[model samples]
Target chain A: MNWTIFHQQVFPIRHKLYRFALRITGSIHEAEDVVQEVLEKVWKTPADQSATIRNWEAWCMTLTRNRSLDKTRDRAQRRTAPIGQEAEYQTDGADPARQIEVQDLTGQVRRFMEDLPEKQRMVMHLRDIEELSYEEIAQVLDISLDQVKVNLHRARKAIRMQLQRVFAAEPVQTRNS
Target chain B: MKEQANIQALLDRYWEGETTLDEERQLKAFFSAGNIPEAYQAFAPYFQALQAEHAVQLPGNRQAVRMHRPLRWFRLAAAAVIAILLTAGVFWWTGGPAQQEQQALAPVMPPKIETPQPALTPSLEPAANPVAESQVPKKQTRKGTLRKTRSVAPEPAPEDTYEDPEAALAEIKAALALVSSKINRSKHTLEKGLQEVNHVDILHKKKKETDG
Candidate 1:
């Protein structure tokens, strides 16, 4: 998109892209890079300047997802690399006040999802946060529908266990005690 | 010994990657909609995410995406090109006038001197130098007369009213020497140009004679 339109229409979605990416990747810097890289890839080469993309969100997510996976692969390859080293974007600030913590179970669940495996985190995000389907996830991921199910189920089990632990640890208030 | 007691275990096995595709699809549908039993409610977002992922359509643009690159690049390129073109065009336009002036002036310079060379009888007129006299055509004589008649002031001084007429006369002598050097250079250039032009003319005439 042009700068004006990007500012007017698409820039508003940047935080959304950032948030969604952070939800999946669990690192603010990586998520920012994912969003930046996706945007760059979309607009880099003049050749094939336009594509037949019917959903910008889906297209962007697919690109971001693929890039994040690549980064994870590269990081895995370089086992000596530090986390978020030389990463461009840093949403987290020096002050603890900058940390966004919604005082609710959803926020708690999100934080819990952060502890999940990379693939599981993405699966959880794709299934829960983005509200995508097994078929769509498979398409976006270039995997089979059954693989999506396995991943999603595993992700759910982990999240479910974690949330249960978190809720149990917190003093619960019954509505009709 | 029916399997009702192991149903929970069977369901856990389904979630733990042992389920067949049909079984998974059943679970997907079962968890996708409606009350989504509290046990499954926590997993609902994942289910919704799958649907979102699937819905990832093409660049969902109806009125076509706007491009800013070419316009940005072109505006800059066009401005630069126009500036370069304008400067070049000015040079070209002004350059034509100088070429036309040279074309008009070059032909007239050599011919007037050579054609009138035979008309000077400077020895008969009591001139000092015979060789200079011979070279002095009527045009050269007239040019000398014109130079002398136009200004009788100390020649270089522009106004002969110099307190020391000797210094003024000396200045006039220096000016004459400079003018003579310039005239000699011009005469040499004219002669060379004539030689070249005559050579070309000869070749052209021969070609025409043969062709004719």
Candidate 2:
């Protein structure tokens, strides 16, 4: 394992790989394990294989996805999606009540995303949260670009529908108040 | 108002998965802004969740996965050490012991024959009769003088006659045997010559008695 390549190329993108793994395996610990496994694998790659790899980020994301899926399949148990820590969210200029309301809605949106189908959830996570290109998402997921677009569309539409219901309820609650 | 419409349009494209990464960023910015209109406020949480997801980091010590670089020179050094050891082993196996054995056997070599005696050369002079010098008592006196002379002179440094100690021993034995045979032959010649001299002396004394 060459530490130079791993530290320079793989270390900087560790969070990116972790996020992708978390989206797939749906557990923080499992996701961390998957990222660690991917980084070690990248570190141990022979010089010839490393030379052939053009994009370290994409390769690591792909490895994370595969390792996470493998770990998920091995356990064969229901996995929970990771919820962003409340502390991690920027609540910088908001009133306390507004912060609580935004945090509640954020949890609701996270659940909506969690309810999505596997392909749709992965595509949405990669595209919106991780901000990967359609092509890059396809490369990581080993799916067609068209499939990435289709899954992303369905995933967003589902979340939007769920949001609409919440928004519709908000107006009613406000009118009643 | 135009900016709001454009953001609304970008948001629509974002849901359709038609927005580029830059356009999505714009949408995320607009939704995250504090002054969003009441209608768009419902979607603010979603953009906030995405930002929060982006902000998520891998927890725990980063140093856990790091490894130290291996000591590469150790391999070369090990190989060189093995090579040197093998070469030394081969030398010892092939020839080292015999040379050692030779050195060890050197101190126990049989004493050298004092064959190059300078005094012995004068005994071979033709001007002297062999019968006159063949007396046993006179020969013992000459040997005593030679031994004294040998003790006074510094001995020459010895050189290795041959690598094989056994062969050098055999050659020295053969030379000693040859020297003894030559000495025996000379002793017989001197006895014969001395008998003829005694016969001549006897005949001369009888003729002198007759003449008297």
Candidate 3:
């Protein structure tokens, strides 16, 4: 991992690392900081040792996760407001009503994710959003293959149930109208 | 109707968390394609949101941003400082070259007998003449006995010369305590680094809140 190799092999995964950090930290600014810190740590690894790493992506992701979790833990200690309370993205150039609807939906999804247990949320983010393989997710999260499957299953099931409840309520509102 | 039935079955498996990656992709594609049947329209947003979230990338050239990161030199300096401290701590813990040399030389040194009286009495008892014991040169007899003992004794075990087991134990405990205290201090330094990294964000957020 000279600068060239770092740029090509390691740095390219910055978005994935950023997304994972963002998902864990639940604040874009904090997430960026986490990614920066992770990258710096990775950069500091001796070039020879880093070159021998079999899975650079997994290594970077694991570092990102540890750093993000540290920040989350600190935030917890400080007794701050729960993260991900605000929407993560802003809609642009859309009809005002449609934008509001999209934002609302995004908020609901974010809340659902934030409400999940830590492992489940992390596993879900890696699987669905980052599209990491089960093995990769396990490596990144430092858990067994079976634990990864179990967490992913629980997370998806929870999200499905919440979606069902929301959809179920929507029709009731329509019926009253 | 057949496609709808296929999706329904897939959705069931999806909810069960049994879908393969390709199957999940098919589900995402179906929901994201728009014009979903009214029955499934409510579920479309979940998939849409997944897509939208995936697209939320950092807003600048990552390489450039990283290169120009704030406190870049300071971070490097901090890392260098930590590396030096860790190396120094490890060297100090292992007691540097003097202790290492002492350990290396310990096995080569001769063993000592603290009480020779009892040791010589048993060997002397096996002698033929107790009356001639006084005539015998004690130094020669002791030297001969020591030779016999050395020849009969098994190889000396390394690190067996603790004068006081309890004191040795206390020394080990103290060394461990020192190592642990060093580790705790390092942990605090890392936590402080994390806090410093986050400080800028906190400041920006406060500024935004005040302006708003």
Off by over 4 Å in 2: A77-105, A171-177, B69-212
B1-212 in candidate 2: lDDT tens per residue?
99889988988898887899999998887766667777786787778777766765677554277554333443454455556555665554334776556544543333322333323454664346666546633664566455443432123223433669899799789877966776566556556655665576566546533432
Badly placed stretches (over 4 Å) of model 3 are A82-101, A171-177, B61-63, B68-212
TM-score of each: 0.42, 0.57, 0.58
lDDT of the candidates, in the order given: 0.53, 0.69, 0.72
**Candidate 1 displacement at residue B160 in angstroms:** 26
B5-93: candidate 3 lDDT, tens digit per residue = 99999988877778888888898898767668878776777876776667666646443545444346556766766676677667666
Q: Please provide, for model 2 over A2-68, each residue's C-alpha lDDT reduced to its tens digit, 9 standing for 90 to 100.
A: 4455668778888788777776776777877887788778877876677778888888888887898
Error of 3 at B115 (Å): 99
DockQ, all candidates in order? 0.05, 0.17, 0.14
Looking at model 2 chain B, report the run of 10 residues with the lowest lDDT sum: B149-158
Q: Model 1 residue B206 lDDT?
A: 62
> Model 1 in CAPRI terms: which quality?
incorrect
Query: For model 3, which pairs clash?
Result: none
lDDT of 3 at A165: 94
Q: Against the true structure, what is model 1's DockQ?
A: 0.05
lDDT of 1 by residue, B1-212 (tens): 23333434545765564655555555556545545444445544444333333332222221133445535654565555556555655545434576646544543444433332334442444256666656555556577545433332222222234669798699779978976776566556546655665576566546533432
Best by lDDT: 3
Chain B TM-score per candidate, please. 0.24, 0.33, 0.31
